[model samples]
Target: MTHTILGANGTIATELIPVLKKHNVNIRLVSRTPQHVEGTESITADALDSEQLLSAILGSDVVYLTIGLVYNAKIWEEQWPVIMRNVINACKTTGAKLVFFDNIYMYGKVDGIITEETPYNYISKKGKVRAELAKMLLKEMASGNIEATIARAADFFGPRATEKSIPSVLVFEKLKAGSTAQWLINPNVPRSLNYTPDIAEALYILATNEKAFGQVWHLPTPAPLTGKEFVKLAAKHLKSSDKISVLPKWLLKIIGLLNPFMKEAYEMNYQNEFPLHLSSAKFEKAFAFKPTSYEDAVKETALWHLNR
Candidate 1:
C-alpha cells in the first residue's frame, strides 16, 4: 500500500511520517522544498501546481492533508482557499482517501465542555474558513468520489512544534532560561494539550481504519490544567525555573502594537484567556486508547527542550 501526505514539513507531518512508514514501506510526501524523509519517497511540489499535485495523487491509496497556515487573517483567507480548491480538484481526478489533520477552531464559543457533536458557528474569520473547508471535504466525500476523515487535535506540544503552539513561546522557552515568564490570558482556566507523537499515532489509526471515513474524530488527549499549574510543573521539571507571571491583557495589547502575530493570538485569548474544557470521549471509546498522563507528557517535553 502506498500513502502520500501533503504539507510534509509541518509539525504533525514530521511526526506522522514515521508512524505511516511503520504501516507501509511505500510512502510518499509532498512539500514545496526538498528534504530527505527516511522510509518514504519525496515529491517537491506546490498545491498550485495542478499537474504536480495530480501526479502525486495518482496511485496513492491514502493522502494525509496536513496543510498549515499562519495566524494572519488576510494570508490565511487567501492561501487556504486556493490550497483547498487544488486539493479538491486533484482528488476528484484520482480516487483516493483523504485524512485531514484539524484543530477545534470552528466551535465559536464553548459553553462548559467541547465534544465532537459541537456545532460550528464561529464568528472569527479563521474559524469560518475551517468550518467551510470541512463542509466542502465532506460534501465531496458524500458524493462518492473521495473518501474522507478528520482527526482534530488540541494545542500541540512536541518535537519540531516550536514556533507554533503557545507552550513553545511561553513556557518551554522561558523556563529554559530561568526567566519570570508572563503567560497570556487567565492562568487558572482548563485547557487540553496534546503530545505530538500521540497525535501522529491517532492519525495513523484513522488513515488506516476504513470505518473512520466520513466521521470527525477527536484525537484522545489528557485532562487539561490551569495555565498556572501547567507552567509551574514545567518550571519544576526544568530545575532553574522562576514562578510564572501572567501578562496582563493591557500589556499584551501594548506588545501587540509592535507584533502582528501576537495581536492575532490575543484575539483568540478567549480560550486559555478564560474557562473552557475539551472532551475526547468519543475517540477514546472508539479507539480503546487513552492519552498519556499529563505528568509524563510534561516530563518528556522538558527533556526534549533541554536536549535541543
Candidate 2:
C-alpha cells in the first residue's frame, strides 16, 4: 500500500522513507521541488495547495505529516494554518489515515515530568498553534470523518540534522572541531532527546497498527542527560573529555537583538537551562519497546560525526 510522506527532505523523513521502503511500503514523497529518490515515488506539491495535497494523498493508505513552518516565525504563522487546512480537507476527502510527526513545544514548561497526558500549558504562539492543530485533528476523528494518530518526539537529533536545532550546530559541529561544546547549560537536569530513526519506527508502527489510530503516542526516548553530561559522553566516545560550556545568557540576548531566530531561542532556555524531562512509559508498554541506551546512542552519534 502507498504511504505519502510530507517534507520529503526532512531529517526524520530521510530515515523514515528508507525504513518504509524496507517494509514494502510504496513510499511517495511530497515536496515543493521533489527529486525522485531511487526506489521511491515523488510528487512536487505544496501542502497549501488543496488540489495538490488531494492529488498527493489520493489512494494512500497512510500519510505522514512531517511538514512544518521551519525557521521563520512570521511565515510560520501565515503558512501553517493553510497547510493544515489542506491536509485536513484531503484526509477528510480521501479517508487516508494521517500519522503526524510532532514535537514537544506544545507541552511547554513542566516542573516535574512531561507525560502524554500533560496539558497544553504554554502561552507561546508556536505552542498554541501546535495545540490547536492537534485538537482539531482529534476533534475531526471524533466525528468519524478521519482516522489519525500522532507520534510525539522530543528535540530531534541525528545524522543530517543541520543548523536549525540543538544537536546540529550546537552539538555535532562543536564536538567535531574539538571545542568545548556550547549549549544553554543546565547540568543536573534531565530531558529526553529522541533519535530520528526511533521516532520513524514509532511512526511506522502507528501507520500499520490499526489499534493505534485516534490517539497520540510518545516515541521511545532515552532518559535525559544534562547538557554537560551529554557532551562529555559524546566526547568520551571520541577519546576526548572536554568540559561543556554555555553561551552566556547575556550573549544570547545580545545576539537576539539582531537575529529574530535567536530571539525565539532565548525563550526556550527551559529545555537546556533547567530541569525538563519527557516520559515515554506509554509507548514502551504499548509496543514492548525500549529506547537505545543514552551511552550507546551518544556513541553512535559521535561516530557519525567523526565519520563525516
Candidate 3:
C-alpha cells in the first residue's frame, strides 16, 4: 500500500512518517518544499493548486491531509476551503481513501465534554473555516463520492510540536529554559491535550482499518488536567520551578494589538477560560488504544526540549 502525506514535515506528519515506515508501506511525502526522507518519495506541490495536488496524490492507496496554514483568520478564510476542496477532489480522482487530521476548534465553547457527536457552533473565524471544511468533507462522504475519515485531536504536545503546541511553548519550553512558565486565561479549568506520538499511531490505525472509514474519530487522549497541574508536572520533570504566570484576557488583548499571532489567538481564548475536555471513548473502545498519561508525556516533552 502506498501512503501519501499531503503536508509533510509538520509535527504530526513528522511523527507519523516513522509509524508508516514500521508497517512497511510505500511512503510519499508532499509539500511546497518537502524534506527528503530516506526510503520515501518526496514531491514538492502546493496544496492550493488543484493540478499540483492531484498530481502528487496520484497512485496512492491512502492520503493524509495534515497541512497547517499560517495562524491568521484572513489566511484561513481564504486558503482552507480551497485546500480542502483540492484534496477532496484529488482523493476522488485517485480512488484513494483520505484521513483528515483535524482540530476541535469547530466545537467552540462546549459546555460539556467534546465528542464526535458534538454540534458545530464555532465562534472564531478560524473555527468557522474548520467547520466549513468539515462540512464539505462530510457532504462528500454522505454522497458516497469518496471514502474518508476525520481524526480530530485536542491541542497536542509532544516531541517536535514545540512550534505549534501552546503548552509546549508556555510550559515545557519555558521550564526548560529556566524562565517563568505561562498559562492563558484561567489556570483552574481542565484542558485536554493529546500526545503527538499517540495521534500519529491513531492516524495510522485509522488509515489501515477499512472499517474506520466514513466516520469522524477523536484520537485517544488522556483525562484533562488543569493548567496549574500541567505546569507543576512539567516543572517537576524538568527539575525547575513550578511558578506560573497566567496571561489574563486583557493582557492578551493588549499583546494582540502588536503581535499578529496573539491577535489571531485572542478569539480562541475561550478555550482556556472554559473546561476543554475531549472524549475519545469511541476510538479507544474501537481500537483498544490507551493514551499516554500527562505525567509521562510531560517528562518526555521536557527531556526533548532540554536535550535540544
**Strongest candidate by lDDT:** 3
Rate residue 179 of model 2 by lDDT.
Answer: 74
* Model 3 agreement with the true structure over 1-308: per-residue lDDT tens digits: 99999889799999999999999999999999999999899999999999999999999999999999999999999999999999999999999999999999998899998999999999998899999999999999999999999999988999888779999899888888889999999999999999999999999999999889999999989999999999999999899999999999999999999999999999999999999999999999999998999899888888888889
Q: Judged by lDDT against the true structure, how good is candidate 3? A: 0.94
Please report, in order, the local distance difference test score of every candidate based on alpha carbons: 0.81, 0.81, 0.94
Regions of model 1 farther than 4 Å from truth: none
Clash counts per candidate, in order, are: 0, 0, 0
- Ranking according to lDDT, highest score first: 3, 1, 2
TM-score, structure 3 vs. true = 0.98
Considering summed lDDT, which 10 consecutive residues are worst modelled in model 3?
159-168
Q: Which stretches of candidate 2 lie over 4 Å from their true place?
A: none
Q: Residue by residue across 1-308, what tens digits does model 1's lDDT show?
A: 88888988888888888887777548888988847876678888888677888887888888888978667978877887778778878877787778889888888778778888899977687788888888888787788777788789878887667888678778888888767756776887888888898898988888888888988998878888878788877887888564778888888888899999878867676776766677878888888988877788888888888999
Tens digit per residue, CA lDDT, model 2, 61-130: 8999998566665676788878878998898899889988887878888888788899888656777777
Q: Candidate 1 clashing pairs?
A: none
Which model is ahead, 2 or 3, in terms of lDDT? 3
Q: What are the candidates' C-alpha RMSDs?
A: 1.6, 1.4, 0.8
